[model samples]
Target: MQHSIPPGGRVSGFRLAKLLGEWRRRGARHGSADLAAAVRMLVLDGRLPAGTRLPAEREMAEALPVSRTMVSAALDQLRAEGLVASRRGAGTWISLPSGGALVGGADTPLVGSSMVDFARAAPPAIPGLLPAFDAVRARLPEQLVDHGYYEHGVPELRRRIAQRFEARGLPTSPDQILVTSGAQHALALVLRMLTGPGDRVLVEQPSYPNALDAIKAMSAIPVPVAMTDTGWDLPGIAAALRQAAPRMAYVVPDFHNPTAHRMDAETRAGLADLARRARTPLVVDETIVELDLDGDPLDGPPPVASYADDLVVTLGSASKSHWAGLRIGWIRASTEVVHRLVSSRTALDLGSAVLDQMVLAELLTEPESGLADRRRHLAGQRDVLMAGLREHLPQWRFDRPGGGLSVWCELDAPVSTRIAVVAQNHGMRLAPGARFGAHGGFERWLRLPFVLPPDVLREAVRRLGLVAAAVSGGGSVPHQEVEVPVA
Candidate 1:
């Protein structure tokens, strides 16, 4: 089974530290108040779920750039607010306010410890991944002499990625590629390099939440263009570009997240034309392109770079196609843009892990068969999930996504958040549609990922059915409340 954090489980201190990204600046005070505010926000927003253990004071101080005194003070503040608890032998864990007034409604159920988490959209590693490591191990000795720090990535990996793009009709040179930790990191580099605070950035209405977060983190204003149930609103996007003239427009053209709507070739060309005229760089995310299960013998849609190579910057990842643990993703852009990213990358990290890049290179050199195998697996899982939703929860309407990991499902009532709240109480975790919508749209929808195995998907759907029923019943079900003892 894929690893998931149980509702009352504790994630590693390192993981918690990462979740507290750039939190020091949120409050005017750089010490305890700011740290406390950040932790409180995380707990309230459900990112740091209740019952997750916070790192020890010293550990947190080491993980973040704060003193142990500040960490202790922050914990004290959280304790006073009932957002944290401590046991004699146990470390501090997150807690919701008593009565759940700050988070959900007072009657809202505390999420059970046995909840089946559906928040992650990643799939398990493919079968060949283990053996691929041995392939890389054999070549490790050949490169031991060098210092092993490569900001532009291992040259061989860059060449292989370029060839992969070339095969897809987007001719690319190795210099055009800059490998990063993952797609999110690539996006961060792009956002930092291309846009500044107060600059307008265009994004899909219900786009990737992390992408929106990244834009917000940079303090760039996001101009959303609505993407309907059918597909991209071309005219609407055109209008946004014309009016906003955004510094950058980010789009997931192939197998978009939440909504698995792929932009047609004509629409891709139109977007390219528009971006070209506006002199705006189009950031096309192709992380899910290889996931197409439309039953076509051909490969997925051509890269947006093919539409206008000069105007479009493309992001691709081995995470979606092969495995996420590898942490290998790249940016394919103009050589000039690549140079800028390379120069600015040291501010983020020196480079990606070299060994992971080598493994991805091997995978890329011979990926068609492995890709076909994965597609078959995902297709089977998708079908099983769809069948379960149909049989168990027919009222939850969804489009059969042609490609990508999740299906954007619509509900009759605008209670997606309420359903998620209730589902959390009933041992199921859900990514509410409101999480995807920037302006509180998609309130009637949910993004259900079918990447899990058939049996697991069926059981998850069954649990979700219980939540759906409780939601549709229009009566308050008494929730079993877990009272957390304050620190």
Candidate 2:
């Protein structure tokens, strides 16, 4: 059962004001677009959970330092898109999609509005990314005269990506690197190229949802090997490989998503050996490899590819460690695999964007210092999120993640999806745990990202607590009261 805000209640002026961060810094034309885009992004992203009351136009304008006209224009645009609805006396409220029609579509509002989103597991673009883009703009003229297609990737980018692997103790060459739009694209390409219909693929339980979707899109049977808060089950994985004999295995070794379990060196070695024996090529997603916030700063592990050079296909991306907007990712594999990916990619698209590639190349050439800065920023945010959760939602439980963007939380009731639904009414967006599992499991879990600033995160958790209370009959159920399986 979901609860609604009392009539005439308005969203806090402070929260509405925070939504205008940096919009004024851009100038009026850009400011209006930025303001509208931020609000639209919030609604679509489920942060402005359905039914959240919008601040009065005057209130918003006063708080954000924008004119009333700009605020009205933004609101009018939102109203035209059906993301907001207003009445004679009641204020405007956020609306949800109707009959699968997204926010920018149908004229009808499905539900109400929300103001905070905990669904996004991605980090904000670093303050330094803009400077990198400016540098790339200066260098753009050098490459613009030539034909702007490089399926294998720009030479400098390939070299930098390969050099990153080499720096991490896995020797590589530019010839072994094939750049793609992002890790998801790289994973999709690998799945398409390697697996045929009816082939079996091994994956971690509670794996990245998009990766699971990619496997299913290929019509490949997914054999999930269970992972825990501790790490992967080596024997179980080995048995799955032996039993299912999957053609390919996809694993996220460092700072795994959802669970945030990093594979130990021994487990990595065992999996590599198992995959090699099964002749199964492991597609390792290392997007979060450099985000090791808890480890000794100097004691970084080598790439898993270092152990099984012949069998592992390593995927690297600028998304997790760097800015995702750059949309740059690469695959480091055998030269033969690289060649095949290049040939197969034309069927998907030409190469990545030229400007993004150049920008990423500059970022990769000097990544460690930037990654360190990111680690510190994330660590602080992570603490804030953990502390907030402890204070507001004391009944829920989650192990502290050493790295990665989210905390995989365990709710007391088997109502993770229900909680998510009820949360929308309270202006919070959440990803139900079932989305992460290959099978319809994890109904008692949810992945909550600590990517937002401290104050926003505190508000999100506070809202989550309200929804959790509603779902749990005014109190959290004890773990012994329910026997849900952990992923």
Candidate 3:
């Protein structure tokens, strides 16, 4: 019954150190200034968010492997700048200089106006969406006569969504579906059903930030398994399953976020077998499954739920494939699990928006048909963003994402947070690498979404290159595309 997130989350020393990556430059001099700048970056980036308690100086110093004097000096500098507020007993927490959020704050230069939002990796509605809505409107009068509450979602939508699974070579029944507001909402319900406070949940090392926050919100611990060069670390996951005995494992095997790694059918089978042996529920998120930029998503690997019918719970969303504005997503589990989810869902909300559900039903009535234009559109944007990245910020290295909306870039320097903070002032917002980490690591990584128009993407990356140069203390990048070699 208690659902409110605690007043604030207390970030530990080790986690704080990980958040502040290779904060100090090559030369160790001016440690205080460097540390202050790193903390300032985290605060401004909203990674260290307001009301997040900072660890003690001694603990932070030990974790940062720096002198206590340096830590004190750094905090003093931050306090002087009005970016931090502290008391003898209350300790320190993040605070804006002008007592407002960085975003839309009067004194802050971030996202003031005409800002290009690179943080959100989603696209506009498809052309077919308007027609879908028109189709729904023709039938809205009939639906309005009903009770207007579907704890298990509208029947038409459930059937349409279920048929999508069948097209992907995974048999699904409408009775096995439970629709919700979105995938994030679906995940929240799953967490409520499967986990309790203090229970451990297995997750990818650099997993989705929102998912990580969800786990922590439940007071459950996240047991992370680092991803390998190729894909999932099977042996490492197996070890964690044995050691941690987590309640459930949440993963995005289909075009994973941030890294954009797709799991082959073989890996899916391996993961299913592992979950079977450990008796852990495999919660698979297939949000961006239909965004296969290279080939047909239908012809790709089978749904993860097909590998272990009874043990797997699949989450799907039209937000990525179609449009987030639809606000329609669902859960595909066994009949019993679906019933249980619906039973628990009443505590949250009665159902999703009826009109949006009807529109999605109309869109998915011809499943792959509506998604083709979306894929083609995203592919063009992906190519443009990739080309712009190579031309403008060649010091960064990133693999071509087979699918998904973003490019997972590995910067030459561990300045992802620094670059993100600087980018805010450049009329572009960025999510730093550390935000994806369970304990705030991944300093060399940053996820750049290619969801903007080709022209907008070009301008955004142009500004990004400048931000990178400024952070590295280099000269301004030329407006003309110049490919620099990445060592």
Best by lDDT: 3
TM-score of 1: 0.74
Residue 409 error, candidate 3, Å = 0.3
Encode model 2's per-residue lDDT on 54-95: one tens digit a residue.
878888888887789988888877777777767766567765
| Superposition error at 263 for model 3 (Å) | 0.3
Give the lDDT of residue 437 in candidate 2: 86
Q: Please, what are the lDDT tens digits per residue for candidate 1 over residues 19-85?
A: 6667777553567888888777666433554545566788788878677888889899988998987
Cα lDDT tens digits for candidate 3, 132-181: 77788999999888889999999999998888888899999999999999
Error of 2 at 152 (Å): 0.7
Off by over 4 Å in 3: 1-112, 474-487
Error of 2 at 36 (Å): 20
lDDT of 1 at 257: 85
Q: In candidate 2, how many Å is residue 384 off?
A: 1.0
In Å, residue 122's CA in model 3 sits off its true spot by 1.0
Residue 327 local lDDT, model 3: 88
**What lDDT score belongs to each candidate, Candidate 1 first?**
0.77, 0.76, 0.82
TM-score of 3: 0.75
lDDT order of candidates, top first: 3, 1, 2
